[model samples]
Target: MMKYILGIAALLFFSCGNKEDILLPKADRTIVKEVMDLSPIYIFFRVNGKDTLAEVNRKNSISTTNWILNIDKRLPLRLVIPEVMKLQEKRRGDSAHKNEAAQNYYSYADSIGKNLAFIPFTNVHYKMVKPKAEVIVFFDKSNKIWVNGLMIKNDKFKNFINEFIDKKSENYQFCFSEDLSFGNYIQYEIYLQSLKINNGQEFIN
Candidate 1:
């Protein structure tokens, strides 16, 4: 009778441990699409202070007529091209903006990495750190970072590192600062959503 009781207790303990592990929170892989106004969408590209609608279509393989019509149909497509292009141009104008931010993160990570080099820390993954001490967090973009399993802003961290494929190498410094934190031991995460699309295919540039 004593042996049977001990066996049952061991089994129960193992079962509970497995249950806890299974219940651990994980990031969702769903892409939340934001709504935008569908109207006279100005479909034009500029090169050398000239409207290059034809050139944009030729270079980007984006058909303005088809794109406009598809918008009219309310298809499930994100207008990531023109928006991304505009972002690229802006980044080019401010060359040091990205490098400066990246450098700051790397500097901080070097300090921390050296100190905690031997200590094994779980659930903390560093993505990018600049020499200037600007750190980019991976897991912060997901809903898992919040206590309630909902997405919340971390104002403490000076930046949130978002990953997007750049085919043109337009936005090499892909990370951006979402929030600011002025302390050591920053906590965050990265959430991988749906497969990234480039030119209507899963391609990362």
Candidate 2:
């Protein structure tokens, strides 16, 4: 009877121990599982304002490479450890390249001649002259000029008219002419881009 009681007690102890072991949650299982299901190259989390190594560390409490492994269990341990340093170098190189490109995108105009005339009127004699005397532009609150069914170059022409045109009806007809020395005939067309606010958010004339 004593032997049977001892055997039963040992069996119960072993079974309970096995159950506890089975129930024990794996360390960082949530984080590990989340990482394991993701591919290494596309696995990304925003670290800072744009996405850099430091931001990853600050947010994830680990290096960027380690974070990669947490998502990709197939990653070699050696590769995971050096990811942060490598990413930092890559980020620095990318920034330098962008800066270089921006530096090269500058143009200086030595002489910008005023070679265009802008005229405002309700109705003017629509005549094409030999030298194209003047390009007459018409405008109300929402008017756009077009040539051959294509819009013109100036997006802020409405603002220019509004600024110069007098509110009084008597001064509604305004003529803007460039000196003949600028050019005999310039080829250009105007189109209404949008009926929206200018920089001041005021309705353009």
Candidate 3:
């Protein structure tokens, strides 16, 4: 099933004239934990805006060769998931030899019968593509949205996103209050899906 998904992604990669980069979809929680256990270095993501990945890596002497992700479980899935994707992007190599470090990252993913490549779920199969323009979306506890730091009514979300889409805006940064409930978060996720918004980074206050 994993291969099938990746194969489809590869086809999409080519079909789109290689315009977009293919990313490994999110892995199961258990699998992620197992990979972390086997890894020598751990890269942790915190909600506080203190530590950047580069800082942590440099401080720990973490080489790109071996490291696993560690995100706080208390963080909402909506907020943290996109950061994980971004982390994968940060760790990726140049388009020519991107998967060079795959072996160190995904050996454990392979042993679990995933039949994935050296860096399973590590975006090893896809080429790298940089994001276009960035659109900032912030939501308060009341679910009110602010676009590019300007406040807008909730009903205007679709219109705002559609306008951006027309302008070829492919990247979004989603920021929301930490007090939001999982149910509220899912609603926004579904709404975004309905709007055909697929590529974005997320943050929680």
On TM-score, the candidate that comes out on top is: 3
Candidate 3, residues 35-136, lDDT tens digits: the string is 332333222334347632211222332333455432222334445444444656556634554445443342112223443232234432221222223676
Question: Which residue window of length 10 is worst by lDDT in model 1?
Answer: 68-77
Per-residue lDDT of model 2, residues 1-205, tens digit only: 0010111101111222331100111111111112222112211222356533211222322222222211111222122224433443443356434332111000011112211112111112221121221222432212334322334445655565467534433333222122111111111111221322111111111
lDDT tens digits, residue span 1-205, model 1 = 0010111101111222331100111122212121122111122222356322211122222211111110111110122233424433443455544332211010011132221101111211222232121221222222123312334365522232133333343332222222212111122212221212112111111
- Compute each candidate's TM-score over C-alphas: 0.16, 0.15, 0.36
Which of 1 and 3 is the better model by TM-score? 3
lDDT over C-alpha atoms for residue 116 of model 3? 29
Q: Which ten residues in a row have the lowest lDDT in candidate 3?
A: 1-10
Global local distance difference test of model 1:
0.21
Report the lDDT of model 1 for residue 27. 20
**Cα RMSD to the true fold for all candidates:** 24.4, 30.4, 14.1
lDDT of 2: 0.23
Q: Residue 192 error for model 2, in Å? A: 62
